[model samples]
Target: MFTNPEQFANATKTLFELQMNTFNALTSKAVDGVEQVIALNMATAKNSVKGSVDAGMELSQAKDPKAAMDTAASQVQPAVGGAVAYGEQLKVIIEDIHKEFTEAADHHMAEAKNTLSALIYDVTKNVKPGSENAVDVIKAAIDNAFKGYEEVTRATREAVKTVEQEIAKATAQVGALKPAPKNEAAE
Candidate 1:
């Protein structure tokens, strides 16, 4: 539909630049997310190693087998709590990354759709008198494509929301973990 080579080249260049920008933004987000995860892992690992060494020392200092067993048993609740905390922290990181990625993608998609629609409009404006039907057909096809894209995006968002809800529920349950009452354990 382009009337001139120059116009066509310009449009192509615009599209290419938009796509490259989107790609770069997404890549940066991914790198940031990975860095956050790595930092969390490193911190968790250090704490875990320290906790293990302290627990070992306590167990070793026990005067009898029963004391040693009791020392080990007391460590269970803290270990579970630490694990739950770590999971929650990881979840937060992942959710943040997801939110940022979704925003970036949505922004890019909107920009692309607008740009393409404008380009199409510009190209169709100088149509030959007898080519009105062809222009209409082209416009209809583009409209339908955009509509389909919208529907898919909506469904995907709902799916992600449901998944996030489930994760929250699971995390809550894990966080609620508790050791049995001392009386009950004694029985």
Candidate 2:
């Protein structure tokens, strides 16, 4: 709906730049997420190897089979706890990425909508008298499109909230299941 060739070219260039910027931001975010996951995995692997070595030593030093069994049993709870903590960390990373992406997208979408509205308004101002009805119809369509976008955005936000709540609940449950004291186990 641009009036001049220059206007159309400028608009096209602006849209292209916006898309490129968005792509770069998303790619950077993905890379960060990957880095986090790699770091976490490396740390987890290191600790696991150390733990295994230490456990082996402890078992080797045990005077009897029963003592070796006790040593192994003592490591179970901590291993499970570590696993749960790792899962929670992953969840946090993923949620953070999703949030950042959503915020960026929302910002870009709003900017685009405003730009489009302004362009439409400018174009409509130059229309002849008989074309008023067509302009009105176009404006109405644009309004409806915006309304639809808002509704979808709202629903997506609600869904994200629900998923976050569920993850929190599950994490809490796992956290609550700490191992009982050795003395208690004896009883």
Candidate 3:
């Protein structure tokens, strides 16, 4: 449908560049997310190691077995709390990445749509008189494709919302849990 070789070449080059840019943006976002996750894990691990060492030292200082057991039991609640906090932090990071990806994709899709429309317009400019029908058909097909893409994008957003709600509910349930009493006598 291109009017000339130069137009076709330019269109191809523009589309290819758009695709490459999109790929690079997405890959960079993924790498940043991975780095954030790794950093979070490293910090968590370091804290966990320190906590264990401190607990061990405390237990060792206890004069009797009962005291040692009590000390160990007392550490359980904080440990559980730490785990819950870690889960919350991880969830935040994941959500951030999802948001960034969605925004970037939306931006690129808009750019691609504009580029395609321009190319189509240019091609249609040189259409032969008898080729009006073909041009109309191409326009209709492109419109339908755009509509389909919009529908899918909406559905995906809704699905992500549902998943986020479920995660929040689960997190709340975990946070609501109460640690076991160390000694019934003390309670």
Candidate 4:
């Protein structure tokens, strides 16, 4: 029990500040992710332009139809490889951001639960005689709420894991389907 109103107010202010700090950290992470994406895009665009120019020059110098076809075939494997690498990098960035956000949120939730529990315990301790049953009921209710929250969080984590596994399987299949070097060599 907070015997003093000032003490309660101070606790409230501290909680508010903690929330603001968490929010700012999340915002900074989001901005950093965006910057990384933009930088990747810019570099990809520059490389693409350079590749196009170089390929054009090579194609122009081709001695015949076979040479032209060979030049074009050589570009395919590199382009496909670059695309796959880019996708993997982008996925990593997204996962990192999500991981940070989840950790921060979990930390905040735990802090809040502890604070509330402590406050409840203090209040119940200071209560008049014959209020033990009421305190028990309050504690039970809080326990049930925590149990429900834990179940939901577990379910959500399992779903996310399932999705990630599916994505990984699909990516593996796509990689396996890459054009065989033997076929490209035959060209």
| TM-scores for every predicted model | 0.77, 0.71, 0.77, 0.66
Model 2 TM-score is 0.71
Query: Taking the tens digit of each residue's C-alpha lDDT, what string does model 1 give over 13-113?
Result: 87677667767877798799889989999999999999999999999999999999999999988888887888788789879977987898788779879
Off by over 4 Å in 3: 131-186
Reference-based lDDT, each prediction = 0.80, 0.74, 0.79, 0.68
Give the candidate number with the greatest lDDT.
Answer: 1
How do the candidates rank by lDDT, highest first? 1, 3, 2, 4
Instruction: Report the error of model 2 at residue 51, Å.
Output: 1.2
lDDT per residue for candidate 3 within 1-187, as digits (tens), equals 5666797688678767877776687678879978998999999999999999999999999999999988998888888898789779878987988798789768877977897788778768889988888778766765665565557557656766776677677767777775865576885
Candidate 4 per-residue lDDT, tens place, 45-146, comes to 888889889999999999999999989988888777766666676667657756865676577568657865775666566766777786677567556655
Q: Which 10-residue span in candidate 3 carries the lowest summed lDDT?
A: 141-150
| Residue 168 displacement in candidate 4 (angstroms) | 4.1
Which parts of model 1 are misplaced by more than 4 Å? 130-173, 181-187
lDDT of 1 at 117: 92
Point out where model 2 deviates above 4 Å. Answer: 129-178, 184-187
